[model samples]
Target: MTREQFIKRIAPIAVQLRAEGSPIFPSVRIAQSILETGGTINPWNNLVGYKVGGGAITPYWQGKSVRKLTWEVYDGTRQDRVPADFRAYDSIEDGYRDQDLLFEKDRYRRVREAENPEEQADMLYMSGYATDPNYAVKLKMLMASYGLGRYDEEAVQLRKEWQERLQQLEQRKQALQARLQTLRQALAMTEIPEWAKEAVERAVQSRLIDTPLNGSYDFYRLLTILKRRGVI
Candidate 1:
């Protein structure tokens, strides 16, 4: 996805996270997340430096990571292998979600122990969580450059606006959907063969059941809940 799409998708989650006392993540920190996750420029679409596998198990993932410990460049380069338990995701949004979950994990107690982004970045860098010596500095720089220092204030104002806009959008979308559904039901009520009605109903249900493509849900639940919900 494009950078704008990525930002729009993760912004709410980031704001909610900070609002819930998850450390005020600056816009820069979030952008840095994009960078680490293979931003729009890269194809990896990894939001966090989640490596495959190395004996560490993400509380959210029932299966082991793809690699034990893989090499990732910490100095703004994807080259050079570094020993880290990198997390992986199928989509950019899932990566961000995983990062949030990872931070909440007890293993990252030091990061949770930090009170601010600077300290958190430092702790994450120094504690072997990130290998780059300048990781903290870069994160701070990103924060400043993007004017993310005012994350909390911005989040509040934007959240209010977002709520208003979301309400309006939802209302509009619901109206449109209702009209479409009504039209479908009317059409179904009209002269139509049973086979054709079944086909249309199946098609609509199929669309409704489009499964959430992201990872994180346990495999069994992922199957059961999504399927039960009529999602793929």
Candidate 2:
């Protein structure tokens, strides 16, 4: 796929993940994805060349992996055609989530703690995330050329708005739940008033009401009046 298409597909998801508390910036994510995957999604959904390591399992990764020839640099020597087992995921989002989990490690703490995309990119290199000496430069170049940093701003605003919306919905939910609880308690009927006990019993026998005991005062009064009016 074209780079634009790749960005279009991945950027929104990366933005959402960032908004939802993934420490990785959208700019760094998109840049790394493009750099690693060449703007194309793999069938296994391993877009960032995340290799298998330490037998870690996340909700997003179920221990699936794929073998691929990868490049590596060591002590000023470059090595290519190195077959490696890269982690595979059920979906692109899953792949991103799994990669974000890797950033939780102590070794990658600096990468997560980086203040911005450029700093994060530099941290990724400094922390030995990639073997290439120019890994940070390449990432920064991609970010600059693609304007990926805009997503970070977008995510910040989106997260704020989402939190507000979530709070409103939560308040509404709590109100509804409390109302439901009150209604449930009301339905349980603590006592049937003496004035309406006979009417309530008759109504229950006639199958007009299921239980006569503990009917609310208003409910019992209504039933008695209705019975007197031959409406029950």
What are the lDDT figures for the candidates, one per model? 0.58, 0.90
Task: Say which candidate scores most in lDDT.
Answer: 2
Shift in Å, residue 128, candidate 2? 1.2
Error of 2 at 94 (Å): 1.9
TM-score of 2: 0.78
- Give per-model CA RMSD: 19.7, 4.4
lDDT of 2 at 232: 66
lDDT of 2 by residue, 1-232 (tens): 7899999999999999999999899999999999998899999998888899886788999999999998899898999999999998889999999888888989998998898789999999998889999999999999999999899999999999999999999999999999998887767668666788778877987899886776665788889998899876
Instruction: Give candidate 1's error at residue 46 in angstroms.
Output: 2.7
Model 1: per-residue Cα lDDT over 61-127, one tens digit each: 4343443344545456665544554455555555555566766667677776876677777777766
lDDT of 2: 0.90
Each model's total of backbone clashes? 15, 3
Give residue 12's error in model 1 in angstroms: 2.5
Q: For model 2, what is the error of residue 228's alpha carbon versus the real structure, in angstroms, after optimal superposition?
A: 10
